[model samples]
Target: MNLNLRHAIMQNISGNSQEELRETIVDAIQNGEEKMLPGLGVLFEVIWQNCSEQDRQEMVQVLESSVRK
Candidate 1:
């Protein structure tokens, strides 16, 4: 059997508002469960695909800063 994770994740969150999306992300991080990682990755993929180049650069900078800590 095959699973389409990205499509499934998007469908699950299709109608979420900004507040709900934030809550979901915060909760996932706070919970620190490995299962949530792929979903976060998919979300980040969506953000990366949609965001501007400057925003992508900023995000990479933030990640670099976080990793150095």
Candidate 2:
């Protein structure tokens, strides 16, 4: 898992249709991928750094709910 490649991918497609991205990610997860999730932490970090206060709170809540599961 290359962090630089991950960052590049995120930046390049940051504005693309999210549904397509979600489907691709879900497919990866269905294939029993490990990097699919751990990479989320990096994405979340990027979002956190740029998100507003309300968005940050929402992100934390969403992440917490997943953690509880």
Candidate 3:
């Protein structure tokens, strides 16, 4: 079966408020399921696209720090 996963995930959460989105992210991370990774990636992609360069750099720094532990 063909699936546009990103599109489907985005569509599913399109109307979510900020709090709802935060809860979704928290739940996904807490669950730690492989299936949730793609959804988190899409969320990160949206955040990356919308953020400023400085914000992106900060995120990169955080990512780097996270992986070093």
Cα-based TM-score, every candidate:
0.92, 0.51, 0.92
RMSD values, in order shown: 2.0, 3.3, 2.1
Candidate 2: residue 22 Cα off by (Å): 2.1
lDDT, ranked from best to worst: 3, 1, 2
What lDDT score belongs to each candidate, Candidate 1 first? 0.93, 0.72, 0.93
Over the stretch 1-69, how does candidate 1's per-residue lDDT look in tens digits? Answer: 125988899999999999999999999999999999999989999999999999999999999999999
Deviating ranges (above 4 Å) for candidate 2: 1-3, 11-15
As a whole number from 0 to 100, the lDDT of residue 57 in candidate 2 is 87
Which window of ten consecutive residues has the lowest lDDT sum in model 2? 35-44
Candidate 1's TM-score reads: 0.92
* Model 2: per-residue Cα lDDT at residue 64: 98
Give residue 34's error in model 1 in angstroms: 0.5
lDDT tens per residue, model 3, 4-57: 988899999999999999999999999999989999999999999999999999
Write model 2 residue lDDT over 1-69, tens digit each, in one string.
577877776785578687876765667678777766755555556678898999988878998999999
